[model samples]
Target: MKYDFDEVIDRHNTFSMKWDCREIHVILGITPRFDEDTIPIHTADMDFRCCEPIQRALRAVTDHNIYGYTGVFPGGYGQTYYDAVIGWFKRRHDWDIKAEEIVYANGTMEAIRSCIEAFTEPGDGIMITRPVYTPFTGTILKTRREVVNSPLVDREGNGFYEVDYEDFEAKAALPSTKMFLLCSPQNPTGRIFTDEELLKMAEICRRHDVLIVADEIHGDLIRRGNVFHPIAKVAGPEGIITCTALNKTFNIAGLQATNIVIQDPALLDTYRKNANFVLPNPFTAAATVAAYNEGEEWLEQLIDYLDDNIDFVIDFFREHMPKVKIRRPEGTYILWMDFRDYGLTGDEIRERIYEKANVMLESGPQFDPERGEGFERMCVPTRRSLLKEALERIAAQFPEG
Candidate 1:
């Protein structure tokens, strides 16, 4: 209650891709069948106001007004940003990492793309889950490597997605499959992976010599009762590059910053060599340092608000939309709602809901082709009142039986 979860902030006219993207709004009108303006909850960006401390720091940069060419890594934002992540790993996760092991990049997306390019050759194979963050597929394909799918299998009402271990090992062992991207506190599902699961995954990738790219970007967002483990902590640190950022946790994603931690110096060097594609600007550093250093209190408050939103969502589904099921995610503000019982195709459900209520949600198909069909990702970082209103609208879209 300390943070205002019911507060509404306007994101339109702010150059927000989620809010201001006219093209997507038009396309959405086709499927989700929205009017010119819709309540968009489809994209991953948070609707909350930017963390105040980060805004102050960016303002400080503007006041300086130098705006010259900036150096990458080991300066300004890089120095303090590195310390913050190191502190975070030690404080929250109980994992200690050397500052030298951490590499800087524009963001996790760019870092993953560079990792694919650096770790594998053309025609090599990469493995990732479908119904996953869409960029992972394109990043690997851009490397001219084949992407192998080990779709996350949902069994009955388990309310979680699991990889086919046999298929994973087989693909990893192939001479072609050279890397595997793991999204922990996974998006959509919000499942904080078990230690046993991460260990098994790391072992298979290790045995097959496939580099492990663990995207623990949501690690900092884990709830109080659950623990979010970094894969490298259990995997014993060989050929593992950990990609994470403060953007998701603090809702400062536009800061354009993230860290890539690789234990092996040689591999880290090669990754840096291949990562010349995008250089982060100074504001990225300014906002990042501000986030890591002074943003903890804000983050804690945000977490509490999100938990309330989660509770509200569950209540709404149970009372008004009983056909949809949720897993009560342990981390990540994203929720994966299962509507398989309704027997509507993901697209059908999405289109119908949007057409009826003007509420936009991430349809399941974007995560993967098969497993994603029954689910939708709803981000709960916005105002609880708005989230409630949106869910009610979505439910009203379904005609009473």
Candidate 2:
């Protein structure tokens, strides 16, 4: 409770993609059904203010006042940057990595794109689990690579998803499939892959010589009781490209900074030569250092607040809208709610949420064009009052018979 998460800061007119971008609807191919009163709980970014240390770091950068080209190691930033990143992983995740193995990237998606380009050629297959972050598929297709989807299984008929190892191995065995994009502490479903699961997937990929790019961007945002295992830690460091970033952890996605960890010397060299060189801006460097080092207290508190928020949503839905199927996610602040019990089409569901409830949520179809129907993803990092209000509005529109 040191940081005021309840404080509702206005993000309007801030050029925020979630709040200010009217063009987002068109971009997402969503019909403009929402009015100005619609509460947006769609995007993955947090509405909460970043930790104080990050703010202080940025302030220091501005105080210095010379916005010039900044190198990674210039002005003694190398040791601090490396130490913060190294210390954080070691201290928090118990995963030890070297500074030399880390490559700078602008963002997780950008890093993934670079990995796809560097590791796989055009017409090559990049395997991914659908009902996932849409960007994974988009990036693969945009780069002219084949998207080999081995859909996650919802065995219990609940929202919780598990990797289908049989299907995964079958897909990995494909001669054309050259890489696997792994989203640990996965988005949407928020299923934190267990060590067993990570190992099984890694073994399959390794057996088939399919490279693994583990996007651990959401790795640190787990629920209180759950543990997250990095793929590199579980499957050894060789031939695995792990992408880590402070953006999602600190609600600093706009900063566009990420570290690509490639422990294999040859793979690292290939990535460095193929991937675009991303220079670290002064603000980004300061924020990264501060976030990895001094932002833990704030992050812990934030996780606690998010846990409460998740509980609130679960309880509210169970009481007011029992037909809405949702499982408690192990990680991330997203709730994947299944509304198929209502017997509404995806378009109807969209209309009900956007027009009737005046709540903007991510439609299921956006994640997986086929299987993601009648589902919606809601992000819960806003003020509790706003979240409550949005839930109430949604519940009113979808009253139980």
Candidate 3:
């Protein structure tokens, strides 16, 4: 069955965090005065519907109508769930994973917090790349750990970013730095680290005794012709805790199911002890089983549509708003845009985009307090027509001189 990627779904009254939540914007320092006509392209989740198989799985669960306590323990659903996860990774990424290595979590952030508690002490430094996902910083700080930032250097002065290896080694070597929170196929910037890069970073952490927590939720969302290597695959599984989830890939984040892969027994035991006991949601279990086993066709088609949407934005910006620098992302549906050429403060840019243009965008400073000025992260997973309209509205706000 062919899916319609062009269909525009109305998400206004569905309690969507991206659409209905105006107070969240105000809390995040964005203007909250958008009317009903406003378009939001900030949140990372897609506006697309889940695949037919996943929908069918959820309906089956609903039909059962038994919402009792459930789990993926041993018999019954356990083997099926594990087999789906293992098969998906083996087939898609060529990385073989064992059933024993998989641990369940409510969400990726929750898993990260548990890792922090289980591994590091309070006041220990957790390293991250700036102009990164804001939640990484928030999670580290909220866990009472110091945030050691190794800012990604855009050496070309274009939007492309490279790891400053020398700086990374220096931070890892710090006695206070106990862990490295890595974002593979990194967020916002969208650069998938090469094997050599991954190995170098992993080696540094191993030598410095820094625990490595790799967030690989975006592993399967690579743009065409690009590949994403699981850091655990590149840098051996020891001392590495890999976070994987079908939520991002299958557009089922609200279901809140995440798989934390720990190949080392010691690390796995420690994580389990510290991590909250996440009782499996029946709907999430059904969704994951179907998604991993049968949703590949839909995923491939979705990627093609997403790829076109990305190119459309790149072309639209180049033609209409040339000063707004953007490059095609190698992975993820996010586009990290540089707005420094306009010479406006981040707040001014946000005001114009939110108030005048009435299009909601994630402001740069939310990702990085210092270097993220005059930048914005746009999530481009909506219908192409709506995306074009949003871009045109934004272009009207910032006229080309």
Candidate 4:
């Protein structure tokens, strides 16, 4: 309990997309039925304060006030940030890493989009597991590449989304399939792929000469007892392209800093060439270095608090909202709650929350084009008091048919 995670901070008037339902509604072409007073749990971003180390780093950069072009490869703290990544892998997963193998990114999603641009040509097949982060699908499709969804299977009671290996292998086996975008500690159902699963996936990709674009963005936020096995470690010598960012782990999403690790030299060369003028965000870079170097203690505390929040929420649902089934995620603060038991469509759920509850949550239909229709993703990173209040708002509208 070194840090008080329950500190309530005012996020309104800060231009946060989460707090403004009207802004989202206007942009997305939906009518804003919810008022300005609604509490939003739609955005994937956290509500925690930035770590002191990150704030210091950003402040140091602003202290200079020289916001100009920065193209230098060896920017301030680049070496330190790289070193921190190496140490993190060593301490957490016992994996050895070399500094030269990784490259910086504005963000994981941007890196993923650039990877699509760099590694493959237009019309190439970029495979992904559905019920994934929404932007991932668009990242591929936006690049003029095809989004081939190898949807994950949820065996009525297993909770986490499991892939059909035969289907995955079949997709990789295709001549058009060039890359597989794997979301570890996956969004929505929050399935952390085991080492055995990684190996099996690696085997398929390797045999088919397909590249694996592993998005381990939520890797560091993993829960206890669940081991996050990085795909590159098991993909033989041709390790998968890893896309990770410090934004999610440290609640610095606005900082937009990430590291894309490509073990193969040829692939690395291709990606670096693709992102010709793209530079690692300067302020973001500085903050990432500081956070990685001095923010481990903060991270440990944050994870512990989040774990408690996860447990509390799970218990709350089991007791008061038993109709809403949640698959306890092994990672990430975003909890995927299945509301199919209520027999409400996605639109119905959205309307009910906005009209009756005054609470806004992310509709599942946005994640996977299939099962996303009947689910909702709730972010549990805010203060427990706020969460309790939001749930109470919904409780007032309980027993809705």
Candidate 5:
């Protein structure tokens, strides 16, 4: 591999939220549990270094050192910023989008918040399937909307979770339910919604007049055999709003850049009016163009590395920790593991992992209180050796029964 994903760069004292945030234990309601030596396999941020091309682009900005107020969209020779996303969707997803349809935002959550504020009234219902990404709920409540859960069905004996269409339709049928926030290549479970599943979901949301906010932020990180069906593709272009970014894929999240694509001019207008959020930093804008254009090779290589990591995780657990079950994620670097066999509550599991293993993982309850119980989300976007060591620590503490 041209990129050395195994290389570990020390992030301690770097002000990295994932690594340096002692306050996380406070947020998680645990005593501050870890030191600088703790392996934070908790947050979604990649432990590996970012694509070189993106770093180089940011470096050029630092070299200039002007640091003045910058325009929102790249202009002049930099019009490639627009062309970058346009060409990306076309080349990668086979989903063609126009320049006018694209809107820039700092992050996916910001875009979702804006969409919620724009389309839904306070106290209106927003439907989500769980267990899901943590921020999905945070953004909903932040905007004063009600969270309507259409929890997914946990298939018996198998680790895979499936969408509960009946519950979904019932939830959407609620008159107050205004929108559905869809996470493609879903975060913790890593299930890529099949075309059939997406069609069913789209039909229900459309029939009930619920707007669709598709967060395809993890779309590019799909495993080899899986296909990512964008909600817009199934739901059509009308009321669907697709949010995507290179932050997760290219590990440039600190840049705070994301792309929002909405085909409906009236809806876009409403969203822009409500969101009125800050524009991307000049470095982010510059690096985004570089990521969408030149970062493809790096992304492909990264996916290959992640694929191996996934395989290693599955094998390691099967061999050493058979009590823990994993479905083998279809997408995302985040691997959801079920520790229910140990009969421990989510908090118990989390506390054990922290105190005994000294590895920080996102507890399932943090995703959804009920569905997330007995589950833990482990991020595998780090060096394989480090991941193995973390797993060894965990396995040593939670040995197979």
Candidate 6:
């Protein structure tokens, strides 16, 4: 590998949300019983360094020492930024995108909120699969929209999951259901929606006049043998809005850059009008251009390392903690672990990890109380040594397993 993914830089004083356990607990409402040095394997951000190209670009910007307001659309370096975005989709995802169809937002979540606000009305229903990324449900509730959860079937023996199409269609057919937020290569479960699945979902939404919001933020991190089918390609552009960002791929999330793609002109006009308050950051724009143009090789290497780390975690669990089960992930660095065999409630698992193991992991219920219980989300984008330490700590506490 050309890049050093094993290198660990100190993030303690960097105001990292993951490293700051006290703050994370306060935000997530997990009161800590004991405080000690803890390794945070929670949150989606990686422990690895940002791609070299992006770091160099940010350093160059800092060296210039002249930070002032800069234009973002077709002015100065803005066109280059836009072209990078277009070129990336064509090169990576095979989706041809136009400049006018792309709108800039500060981040994926911010863009999602804007879409919820623009496309759906208060008290309207937004459809999602349970044991999904928590923020999907949180954003819905925050916007005063009702959350319509279509729970995925467990496929128990293999630890894999599948959508219950029957239930999904039933929810979409509802009169108040206005939109569906599809998390491709979905969080927690890590199942990449196949093209057939995508088409089926598109069919249901179209018949019910529901708009589809595809959150493909983790699309590029897909594992080997799995294909990430972009919803717009199957559903057509008429009622689809796709959100993506370089933050996850290149690890430049602190820069706050995301692209919200809308193919329909009339819908684009409405979304932009509703999200009019968004402003572009000059440094982040520069970093984004650098990432798209020069960071592909680094990204490729990072994915390889992340895949290896996932394997390590799975092997460790199977050998030492057989009671705990994991379904091999198809995309994203986050691994979903099922601990139902341990006979522990979600809070009990959280307590053991936080109080005894001294590691911070995302509790199951935070994703969905019913479906997410007895499951934990572990971020595995760190060095193998650190990852092993976290696993060892947890295994030591559950020795009988």
TM-score of each: 0.93, 0.98, 0.98, 0.94, 0.96, 0.96
Give candidate 4 regions above 4 Å deviation: 29-31, 71-77, 236-239
The residue-level lDDT of candidate 4 at 375 comes to 83
How many residue pairs clash in model 3? 0
In terms of lDDT, the poorest run of 10 residues in model 3 is 26-35
Best by lDDT: 3
Off by over 4 Å in 5: 74-78
What range of 10 consecutive residues in model 4 has the weakest lDDT sum?
Answer: 69-78
Candidate 6, position 55, lDDT: 79
lDDT of 6 by residue, 1-401 (tens): 38887886777767776775576676677547425478778878888887777878888888997788765685465789889999998898898998778888889988899999987889999999888999999999999999999987876667677888899999999999999999987887888888888888888888889899989999999887777867887668888899988888887777778998999888898887776657667778889888999888998888889889999999999899998889899998888888989997777888888778988788888877787788888988888888989889999889787
Task: State each candidate's clash count.
Answer: 5, 0, 0, 2, 0, 0
TM accuracy, model 2: 0.98
Compared with the true structure, the alpha-carbon lDDT of candidate 1 equals 0.79
Better of 4 and 5 by TM-score: 5
Q: Measure candidate 1: CA RMSD.
A: 2.3
Indicate whether candidate 3 or candidate 6 has the larger TM-score.
3
The CA lDDT of each predicted structure is: 0.79, 0.89, 0.90, 0.79, 0.86, 0.85
lDDT of 2 by residue, 125-154 (tens): 999998889989999999999999999999
Residue 332, candidate 1: C-alpha displacement in angstroms: 0.9
Which one wins by TM-score: 1 or 6? 6
Give the per-residue lDDT digits (tens) of candidate 3, residues 1-401. 89998997999989888888878877877667655898988888899999999999999999999988879864565899999999999999999899989988888888888899889999999999898999999999998999999999999988889889899999999999999999988999989999999999999999999999999999999999999999999888989999999879999999987999999788998887776778778998899899999999999999999999999999998888888899789999999999999999888888889888899888888888889999999999899999999999999988762
Backbone clash tally for model 4?
2
Better of 2 and 4 by lDDT: 2
Off by over 4 Å in 1: 25-37, 72-78
Model 4 TM-score (2 dp): 0.94
Instruction: Pick the winner on lDDT between candidates 2 and 5.
Output: 2
Clashes of 2: 0
Worst 10 residues of 1 by lDDT: 28-37
